[model samples]
Target chain A: MALCEAEKTFILHSVEENFRIDGRQRGDYRPMELETNIVAPSFGSARLRLANTDVLVSVKLEIDSPTLEQPKLGKIEFFVDCSANATPDFEGRGGDNLATEISNCLSSAYKSSTAFDAGKLCILKGSKCWKLYVDILLLECGGNLYDAVSLAVKAALWDTRIPLVKSVVVDGNKVDMEVSDELFDCERLDVTGAPIMVTVCKIGDQCIVDPTTAEEHCSGGSVVVAVSKSNFSTILQTGGGSLHPMTLLESLKLGQTVAQRLDSTLINTLKQINDNSTDVGFLK
Target chain B: MSKKKELVSKIGLRLDGRRADELRRVRCKMGVFSQPDGSAYIEQGLTKVLAAVYGPHQVRGNRSKAQHDSAIVNCQFSMAVFSTSERKKRPRGDRKSSEMSIHLRQALLAAIKVELYPWSQIDIYVEVLHADGGVYPACVNAATLALIDAGIPLKEYVCACSASLANNDIPMVDISHQEEMLGGPTLTIAALPMSEKIVLMEMSQRFHIDHLPKVMAKALKGCKDIKVILDEAVRSHVEDVGCSTGWSNTSQKIKV
Candidate 1:
C-alpha cells in the first residue's frame, strides 16, 4: 500500500480540487452494497461491502447475570476478528492490534446511554439480563474500516430480535424465568440512536470522508467521529501529523453533517430491505 | 432405558431428507476478490467457506524456512466466531483449528506442484462462515479451488469428503452436524480424485473394523463426485472470463 511520491502528489492535488481518484467528491462515499441475515445460526447478521472493503457482523445473545456495578443494565460487547483471507499481513497475531483498536472505539461509542440504551436488554434487574455479543469479522480491507464496521454493526443490531420472557419468579436468592418457545415470538431492538462513525481524512489542506486505500496512504492525518443522531458520541484522532485547532473544529463539523446524512440513508435502505428477498452472500 | 433415535429412517431417507449416497447441494464461485492472487467461495449444505491464496513469491518473515528444492505450502483454517450456534470466544489459534490447519496443509501439499517455485512460498487461508459439519473437508475443497484460481500448478484436483455408518449397515456421505452428533463413526478423507490416491484419512469414534472398507469407499466416491462438480465450475468460469477478454490465449478454430 506504499505510495510513491508522484502518486501521493496526484492524490493530494485531486483532493485540493474537491475531486478524488475514484471520481468522488470530498463528502461522497463509495458505492456500497449491504445484505442482512446472511448468517443463519446467529440471531442477526449483516455483510457490507464498500468498494473493495468487506465487513461481516453477527449478533448473538446469551443469558447471564448483570454486573454488580450495573444491575439494571444489560451487557453489550464488541469483538473484532481480522481474518487472514483479507490479507496475508493479517496472518496469525498480526491483526490483533487493529482488532483491539476497532473494538475499543466501538465500545466507547456505544457507552453513552443516549447512543445505545443497555437497560432495555435487561430481563430481571440484578439477577438476569441478556448479553449481546456483537462479533465483527473483517474479510477485506479497502480502507475506511471504522465507518464500514460501525455501519454494519448498526444494521446487525437493527436486525437483532430479543427473546421475550413470559414469566419470572424469584425464590430465595435464585431467579427463574420462562422464555417464549415460538421461533418468531421476539421483540426487535430500537437502533434509531445507534451511532454511525465517519472518518475524515486530511490530505493536503482539505478534509475528505470515506478515503480509499490509495487516498488513505496519501493522507497526513485522519479524524474518526462517531455521531449518534444529532450528537457526537466520540471523536478520536488517528495517524501521524498534527492539526490546527480551527481545522480540527471544521473537520468535526464536516464529520457530524456527513454522518447524519449517512445515517438517514442507511435507515431508509434498511427499511426497504425485504425480509423475503433471497440472500446472495459471497457467491455473487 | 431411553429409546435410541434412528439416524436413517426405514424408507431410506436421512433426517434432512437426503438419501444415503446423495451429497448436499454444492455451489461455489471463484475469483470473488480482486486483492488476492486467487479467491473462492463455497457452500456445502449449511456450511459456507471462503478461501484465498497469495504467493508463489519470495518467502515472507523467516527466510531460513524457505526451501531450496520446492516451495513451502502454508495453510490456515479459521472459523468465524458466530459460525456455530454457540458464539466462539476467538476465531482461531485454538487446538482444533491448529489441528485443522495441519491437516489442511497435509492434504494440499500432496496436490500442489511445489518444485516449480523453489525457494518461494504459497499461503492458503480458509475462513469458515458456517460450520454445519465436514468443516475440514470443506476447507480443503475450497483451498483447492482457490489454488486453481491463482493459476498455481497442481498435480491434480484434491477433494475431501466425510462419510458415516448409519443403522450398522448403510454408509452415508457428507455427514451434517445433526448426523455427526447422533452417535456414529465418521470417516473423512482427502484424495487426488484423478489418480484415485488417498492423501489423508481420519476417523472419529469407533466402529466395527469390518465397516471400515465400506465407509472409506463411500468417502472416496464422494471425493470423486465433488471433483467433477468443481471441474465443471472451473470450466464455466474460464469460459466466462475468456469470452470477456476476447480469448487471446485460446485458438479461434477450437470450440470454446
Candidate 2:
C-alpha cells in the first residue's frame, strides 16, 4: 500500500487543487447505502456501506444493575469485532488492537452529556437498569471506517425500542420490574444527540473528509472529530504523523459543518427507510 | 425430557411440513465478494452462511509448513454474535468451532486436487450469519462452491447432509433445527455424491445397531439430491456468464 514519491505528489497536488483521488471535493462525503433491521432476533440493527467500508451494528438490551457512581444513569458499552473477511491480518488476536481502538473512540464519543442521555435508560434506578450493548462488526475496510461505524450505530440506536416499564414493585429490599407484554409497545431512543464522527485527513496543506485507504496512506495526520449537535464530544488524532494547531482548528470547523449536514441527512434516510417494504441486506 | 416432542406428525409430515426425504430449500450465489479469489453465500432454510476461498499461492507466515507434495488446506468456521436467538460471546476460536473447522478441511480435502499445487496453501473461511441447524454441513457446501468459483480443480462435487431416525422405523433426511432437537439419533454425512463415497460421518445420540444402514443411506441420498441442486446452479451460472460474453450465441454461430 506504500505509494511512490510521484504518486504521493499526485495526491498532494490533487488536494491542493481541492480535488481528491476519488474526484470528490474536500468537504464532500462518499455516497453511502444504509439498511436497518438487517439482523433478526436483535432489538435493532443497521448495516451501512460507505464506499467500500462495510459495518453492521446491532443493539441488544439486558437488565443489569446500575453503576454505584451513577445511581440514576444506565450504561452503554461499545464492542467492535474486526472480521477476518476484511483482511487476513485480522485473524485471531491480530485485530484486537484495532477493535479496541474503535471501541474506545465510540465510548469516548458518547461520554459528553450532550452526546447521549444515559438517564433515559434507567428503570428502577440503582436497583435495576437497562444496559445497551452496541456491537459493531466490521466486514470490510475500504477506508473512513470511523465515519461509517458512527453512522451505523446512530441508525441502529434510532431503530431500537425499549419496552415500557408497566410497573415496579419494591417489596422490602427486593424490586422487580414488569415490562409491557405487547411487542410494539415500546419507546424509541431519541438519537438526535447521538454523535456523528467526521474524519478530517490532512494531505499536503489541505484537509479532506472521508479518505479512502489509498488517500489515508498519503495523509500527514488525521483527526476524528465527533460532533454531537453543535458541540464537540471527542477529538482524537489517529494514525501516524503530526499536524499544526492552526490546521487542527481549521479541520475541526470543517468536520463540524460536515457532521451537521450528515446528521440531518441520516435522519431523513432512516425515515424514508421506515416507509419502504424490502431490505435486501447482503443478499442483494 | 418429558414426553419428548414428536419430530414427525401423525400424518407422516416432518416438523417443517417437509417429507421424510425432503431438504430445506437451499438458495445460493457465488462470487459474492471481490476480495477473495472466490466467495459464495448459501441459505439452507433459515440458516445462512458466507464462504470465502483464498490462494493456492505461496504459503503465508511460516514457510516451513509448506509441503512439496501437497498444498495445505486451512479452514475457519465462525458464527456472527447476533446470528442465533441468543448472543454469542465470541465468533470463533471456541472448541466447537475448532472441531467444525477441522471437519470442514477434512471434507474439502477429499474433493480438491491439492497434490497438483505444492508448496502453497488454500484458506477457506466460512461465516454463519444465521444458525438454525446443520451449520457444519452448510459450511461444507458453501466452501465447495467458493472453491469452484476460485477455479480450483476438484475431483467431484462434495456435499453434506443430515438425517435422523424417527419412530424406530422411518428414516428422515435433511434434519432441520426443530427436528434435530426432538428427533432420535441424528447422523450427518459428507460425501462425493458423484463418486458415491463418504468423506466423513458424524453421529449424535444413539441408534440401534440394525438401523445404521438405513439412516446412513438416507443421509447419502440427501447428499446426492443436494449435488443435483448445486449442479443446476453452476450450469445456469456458466450459461449466464457465457451469454454475457456472447459465447453462448457466437460460438454456435461460428460453428454453423
Candidate 3:
C-alpha cells in the first residue's frame, strides 16, 4: 500500500502529537485474542489475532540426537510459512524473503540460554533429545507481524507438553527408552524465559509499539527487539531507512518495556486459559 | 495373515460410527476476516479449511496473461505443516499441493462466471488446518463459501464429496482418512450440485468397472447434500450481515 505525501505527513504529524490514526498512543498495543491447543495433532498450538494480524503457531516434537557441540541441550527450529490467504502477492515463493526474515529473527532470539533453555528438553544427553519444530503459519497480515508471531510462538511453547519417559536403558551404545502409555502423562515446558518480540516503529520522531499497516508504510524505520525477562535477546533493524544511535537506543528501551508488559500479560492470559474450553479454531 | 479390518462393519456402520451414506459433521462460517474481500472457515469432521477470495481486478504479475473474453481464476491449496499426524517440511510447492491447486481451479472455474469480468483475475487460496480426510472436498466447499461471500457470480454452487467401496459391496460416502487407509477404492467428484454437472472426477486404486456407477451416484448424492448445507450457511450469513446493517428489517425504519 503506497502512501501519498499528504497521507504520510498526516501520519507523521499524528505521531508527533502523541496520537495514532487507530486512536492508540505510542505504547498502546491493539487488542489481541489468543487461543491455545487448537491444533489437535500437534504437541502444542496457538492462534493469536493482534487486531487483524493472524498468526498460528504449532509445535511438533521428534526424538533425535543432540548437536555435537551442544551435547547437553536439545534443539528448537522455527519455520514460518506465508499462506497465500494473507495476500495474493504471497502466492508462491513471493513471501519467502519475509518468512525467512521472521524465522531467522525467532531462531536468534531463542538462541540464548537465558532466553530459552533447551537443556530441559534433553532426554539422554548426547544420545537422545527432543527436537522442537515450531511451525508458524501466517493466515493474515494486518501489521506488527513480528510481535504477533512471537506472542503466538511463546504461547505455543508454554502449552507444549513432552511425553514422560518411564525408563531409559543403554546397552553397548544401543539405547532404549520407554514412554508412559497414559495419554496425560507428560511434562509441561518451562516458558518463563521465552523471548517476546516487540516491533517499535519510528515515525517522524516518536516510536510506536504496534503500528497498523498504514502506519508501517509511513514509518521511516523500525526496530524489532526480543526481550526475555529483563534482558534484550535479539535486536534487529528492519525496513529501508536508518536511524540515529540516540533514537535507536530510545526505541530499544521502548521495545524492552513494552515487551516485558506484553510478556507478563500473555503469561497471565495463558494461566487463565481453561483446558476444557471448546476449541473455536477459525470458526469464530 | 491377520484378518483384514472392516471399512464398513456388517451392521453398515463405518469406523467412525457414521452410516454408509452419512457424511461427517460439517460446520462453517463465512466472512471470518476483514482484510480479504471474502473469507470462510469450514470444518468437515476433523478436517478444517480456511479459504479467502480476492479480486475480479486487473491481472497481477503477468499482464500478458489477461484474457479477452474471460478472467483467469488462480487457486492455491496449502496444508499446514502440522495438519497431518506427522509434521510436513513445507506447507506448499510440493507435487501433491500443486496438483490439488490445479484440481481446485478446475472445479471452481466450472461454476464461476469468468466472462463477466474479462481481462481480470480472481484469486482463491485455501489453507488446510487439519487433514483428517476428504481434504480436497473440504477445500472446495470452503472456497465456494468464500466466493459467495465475495459476491462473485456463479452459475451454481460447486460442491465436492468423496465416496468409497466398503467390503467390495456397499458404497459409502464421505471417506475419512481411516477409511482411505483401510484399503478401499476411493472416488472423489466435484460437481455443480443444482445442475448435476461433474466438473472434476478422480479415483484412486481402481475398482471393478461395474462398481463405478454406484460409487459415482453415491458421490453425486453426497455433493448435493453438501450443497444444501453450504447454501443454508450462506443464507444465514447474508441474513446476519443484512440485519447488522439494518437492511433486513425495513419495516422498523421510520419514514424520512
Candidate 4:
C-alpha cells in the first residue's frame, strides 16, 4: 500500500480542499456495518465491519480471586488475534506485533477505573471478582484498526451479561457462590463511560480521521485518542515521525470532536441492533 | 454385526441422517475481499473457511531461499479464536497448524504452475472461521478458488475430502464435526482430481490394510466430485467477473 510522493501530494491537495479520494469529506467516515450478539454461546459478542476492515469481538467471563494489589477492582483483559484471512504476513507469529500493539493501546485506554468501572465487576470484596476476557479477531485489515477495534469492544461489552449470583456462603476460608440456573437470569455491565478510540493520521500538514491503508502508509505519523464521554482517557502518538506539542494539542481537539460523534453513533447503532429481531453472525 | 447395524440403522442411514456415500452440501463464493489479489469464502455443512491469495511477485525476505527452478509456495493455516466450541489460546503457530500449513503448501504446489514464475513467491492464507469438521478439505477448496481469482497459473484444480471407516465395515464420505467426534478412523486426502493424482494423504487411528485401500479409494472419489463442483464454481465466477467489466454484452446489472 505504498504511495509515491506525487500520490501523497495529490492526497494532501484533496484534503486541503476538504475532499478525499473516495469522495468523502475531511471529517466524513466510510460506511460501516456492525452486528451484536453474534456468538450465541459466548457471554457477549459483536462484529464490526467498517468498510474493508472487519473485527470480531467476543467476551468470556469467569469468577476468580482478585489480585492482591487490586482487591476492590475486577479484571478486564484484551487479546487481539490477527487472523491470516487478513493477510499472509499475519500467518504464524508474524501478526504478534500488531496484535500486541492494539491490545496494549486498549489496556491503556481502559486502565482508568472511571472509564470501565471494574469495581462493579467485583463480587466479594478481596475474595472474588469477575475476570472479563475480551478476545478480538482481526478477520480483515483494510485500515483504521484502532477505531474499529474500540467500537467492537464497546459494543461487545454493552452486550455482555454477568450471570446472576443468588447468594454466597463462606466457611473455613472457602467461599461458594450460588449462580442462577435460569438462562435469562443475568446482570448487564455498566458501559456508558467506556472509552472509544479515534485515530488521526497526519498527512502533509493535515490531520485526517480514519485513514485507509494507503493513506496510513503515506502518513508521517499518527495520534490515537481514546475519549470517554467525560474527557480524554488517553492519547498516544505512534509511527516513526514526531509531532510538535501545539500540533498534538490541536490533533487532540480534532480527535475529541470526532470521538464524540463516533461514541454517539456507536451507542445509537448498538441500540438499533438490540431493538432489531435478528441474530448477528457471519451468516449474513 | 451390532456395530455395523448401529452405523447404518433400520433406515440404512449414517449419522446426521445421510447415506454412507452422500456428500455434504457445499456453498462457496469467490472474490470475497477487495484488498487481497484474490479471496474466497466457503462453507461445507457448518465448517466455514476464508482464503486469500496475495502474490506471484518477487520473493520476500531472503533471496537465498528463492530457487531458479520454480516459484516458492507459502501457505498458512489459522483458526479464529472463537471458531471452535472452546476458545483457542492462539489462532495459529501451534504444531498442528504448522503441519496443516505444510500439507496445504504441498497440495497447492502440485496444482499451481510455479515454473512460470521462477524465483517468485505466491502466498496462500487460509483462516477457518468455523471448524465443524473437514477443515483441511474446506481450506484447500477455498484456497484453490482464491488462487484462481488471483489469476495465478494452475496446472489443475486441487480438491480434498475426508473419509471415515464407520463401524469398521462401511466407508462414509465427508465426515461432519459430529461424526468426527463420534470416534472413527478418519482418512483425509488432497489430490489433483482430474489427473487422479494424490498430492497429500493423511490418516488418524488405525485400519486394517485390507480396509485401507477401499477407504482411500472412496476418499479419492469424494475429492474428484468436489473438484467438479469447484471447477464449475470457478467458471461461473469468471463469467460473472467478466460480465462486470462491460466485456460481456448481456447488460445484466449485479448488486455487489
- For the second chain of model 1, what is the TM-score against the true structure's chain B? 0.96
lDDT values for all models: 0.94, 0.89, 0.94, 0.87
> How is the predicted docking of candidate 2 categorized under the CAPRI scheme?
medium
Write candidate 2's Cα lDDT for A174-229 as tens digits. Answer: 99778999998999998999999999999988899999888999999999999999
Among all windows of 10 consecutive residues in model 3 chain B, the one with the lowest summed lDDT is: B247-256
* B1-256 per-residue lDDT for model 3 (tens digits): 1477878877778899999999999999999988889999999999999999999889998799999999999999999999999989889999999999999999999999999999999999999999998999999999999999999999999999999998888999999998888888889999998889999999999889999999999999999999999989988887788889898677664433
Which ten-residue region of model 1 chain A has the weakest summed lDDT?
A: A238-247
User: In candidate 3, which residue ranges exceed 4 Å CA deviation?
Assistant: B252-256
DockQ of all models, two decimals each: 0.83, 0.52, 0.84, 0.44
Model 3 lDDT, residue A14, Cα: 90
Which candidate number would show the highest DockQ if scored against the true structure? 3
Q: Model 1: which docking level applies?
A: high
* Residue-by-residue lDDT tens digits, candidate 1, B141-204: 9999999999999999999999999988899999999999888889999999989999999999
Fraction of native Cα contacts reproduced by each candidate: 0.69, 0.19, 0.81, 0.44
Show the lowest summed lDDT stretch of 10 residues, model 1 chain B: B247-256
Off by over 4 Å in 1: B248-256
| Model 2 accuracy (lDDT, Cα) | 0.89
- What overall lDDT, based on C-alpha atoms, would model 1 receive against the true structure? 0.94
- lDDT by residue (B1-256, candidate 4, tens digit) is 5433356556669868889888898888898778789988888887888899999888888899898998999898988777787778878888989999999999898999998989899988998877999999999999999999999989888999999888778888999988887788899999998889999999998889899888999999999889888878887888877877766785655545
